[model samples]
Target: MDKASVDYTLYLVTDSTMIPANKTFLDQVSQAIDNGVTLVQLREKSLLTLDFINRAKETLQLCRKKGIPLIINDRVDVALAVDADGVHVGQDDMPATLVRKLIGPDKILGLSCGIPLEMEKAIEEGVVDYVGFGAMFPTKTKKDIKLDRFGQGPIGIRRLLRTLEKHNSSSERKIKCVAIGGINQSNAAKVLYQLNTPTQKVDGLAVVSCIMAAPDAAKATKDLIQIIHTPAPWTQALTITKEEPQSLENKIKTVTAKSPLVHHITNGVVKNFSANVTLAIGASPIMSEFGDEYEEFASTIDNICLVLNIGTPSPEMMNLFKHALQTYNKYGRMILLDPVACGATQARLNVVKELLNYGQVNVIKGNIGEISGILKLTSTYKQANGNEEEVLMKGVDSIAQLNEDDIISTGKQVSKDFKVVVVISGPINYVIHQDRYKSIPGGHPLMGTVTGTGCSLGSTIGSFIGAQADGRNKDKFDVYEAVIGAVELYNKAGREAAEEAKGSGTFMVKFIDKLFENTHNI
Candidate 1:
């Protein structure tokens, strides 16, 4: 179950819309195969046995043709019906040990272990090939119940490693842990990367809704698998902005002067600081919530941008984000969402899910966890073992494991997934839009230990977009350029000030120094 040789990458499970029910059925299956999914799970929830058999036959054929492995979820009968590649059972969904006995070896066998007890039972049973654990986060279809600790988030890479350690003594089939729950393009690598021990790490991701829901399902599937299948050194820590050096510089200066006014429906922790950062960078800042003035406000303002955070979530605030988004659409305003602490809690992440339905966001900023929740990475929506104890969250910040590449990729993926600019801000700020990637590697390390840097970055972006809306600047100050520019200015300041500052107390002074320099004197 270690991270070294896990097979969890590129795992896909077909749980909904079975067997070419429509003309696109086979096309979808073909696309999944084309996307590089290494394994497929046929999860037939409500189909009649005969209908299920027929679909399984077709799926098995398609999978075999592609040379991809196939597993049937919760149905040992189906596994034998089509001589499917494998069978996945749950705590109550036919014991894997028994299914193994019935199906015999050579074929694969999978078990779903939602908790430690279930894991022990599955392990004791011993016939299982690999174990599946989750509804790791929260899902409507998964029937999230109140149990001791049935549902949780990514549980940090360290804890996931530990959990794998606990179960290492089990089967020699190389126990594989897969982090499921809303794993998306932005954060898939983060989850996989966190699984430190190759022997103990989960195999790959298991996504459902995301790949199925995209406008271009095939492209989405292909992209997700392409990135997943890509082995390490992993896309380098950061990539580049193809705008060319002159173009990039011009875009930055032009955007700052244009002065966009960004709207933030984000955390209270950095409200004031975020606004200040925006103003400091020569962009106007507007912090508004959902209210009678939402649409009205969006309409009145030409350069409108939106940001949503989960740090200090309130129902009132949540409602405000909804209204603001409504207003954003009415005005065709550009918006950005920060899925902060997204996978941390059901309530916190629900806001992100709801917001996804509303189109018109120009960017999304988040850490790895938030991004994973947004995408629902692979076939299963579950995390590996032992994470709750290790994954840390105080407010909305990422205080767990370190994954620079995954963080950077999360930003790049935001651009790809939503067709918007993505910013992953931390000790270093990564502004990724489209295929081009750029890293602003200047921020002080202390920035990570602080509170408002992230919120401030989002607000900074909003301000830049607002300025662009004034019609005074060239189109060069697009979202892509704005993000890079913001990171450069923000980090340059942090690093410069860190040279003279000793602690957080002096950090404020140096931050101001850097911010002031970047905004005016620079």
Candidate 2:
């Protein structure tokens, strides 16, 4: 088989230990290929040389009969004896040059790459046909990943791909990329979609338990193929703007008409205020952090939105946030993340990183300091010198000494990298999507004097997003417009409330009253 013609989509790496009790290993492999798997890799690490060769010969016969390419995992001798189509080896295994020499040029060559240096070496060696980038999530299959660096997930994959571009820009033989380890039905789409950036692309996914360990391998393979071919429900309906956008009043009206359920898993400090703000915006509010109910709530509720605020970063709260994030992603629901004081402590920063790595977030709103912290996580941010500049956090409030231009720029990069709407809230707020951004400059300084105002803004945005879940016309439900409309409405309300209030206490009441007027009109 020609290496270039091989289809890498839905690659199945076989593991006999994970096969179902009712089915034999070859039966699962045969069923998976008959359904949708494009390629197969025979990996029998526990077997003796003779047994491994026998198994590889059998697997190769099944793959050849189905016209699917077969790859041997780290056993070149077995592959040669069986005349397998390819061989895959890890960095710690035999080097790629020797593997290519041993396997010769006609057979395919795959390398396991975990970091940028490994990818750079593969590009320089120019012998690898494809590279598997993983342990995308923590899984029992890959026991070699002991450090956090290897467990960087999708974000790490993006970085490694970007590194490839830097080293091999004009090469005609572009190395195909595959994500392996811990990629299952729930996160397979996310891993594939998140890595599909403008600069980087992941060709396919390599799986073990998703198909091999399934009760019915054929059905599992078919379902995964459908998922790969069909577009994810959450990835569509995005509004991209190159110029100034039109009025989003229609989007606002969608919220009032639908009255979408907005779930808030926020901190204790601003629970009541956030709920009131949600209600005032013509959306139903439910503040529940009980992790047990997330799956039911996400699956049953139509057009539901979750506002996940990390103000109180307890271990319990962090775990709940991860559960809620994954549930929302699985159900194609919108989620607004508020990483409160993300740069204030290392613990909080680590919590936010895990959440971003876990699921797809629709909208992320934070002050300049918090947004700056997110920007630093990506490769887009550059320091003035080699040293890292400190961003001060005054107990959930930002005192980061940055100009408005810097904030807007950071918001743009964060939005582009994460593929979400970013709101950098302050006196002059910026709502940014891929390449476009809208600046709303109306909020009063006194709004910051009140507690929970920023947190309430997240609730308002989430309400608008929930309302955008109109099944009538999913294309018309633009999350970008909803987010921009929400920020504009929230800021306008703050400006109006500040003019009518007597003090900070009165300002909070007036802010709610302003939002309440919108509900009456709706």
Q: Pick by TM-score: which candidate is best?
A: 2
What are the lDDT figures for the candidates, one per model? 0.62, 0.83
Candidate 1, TM-score vs. the true structure?
0.51
As a whole number from 0 to 100, the lDDT of residue 128 in candidate 2 is: 93
Off by over 4 Å in 1: 1-8, 16-27, 120-125, 144-150, 156-161, 165-173, 181-201, 209-217, 229-312, 316-522
Per-residue error at 104 for model 2, in Å? 1.3
Q: Go through the candidates in order and give the clash count of each.
A: 41, 0
* Candidate 2 Cα errors over 4 Å, as ranges: 146-150, 241-251, 382-389, 469-475, 519-522
TM-score for every candidate vs. truth? 0.51, 0.94
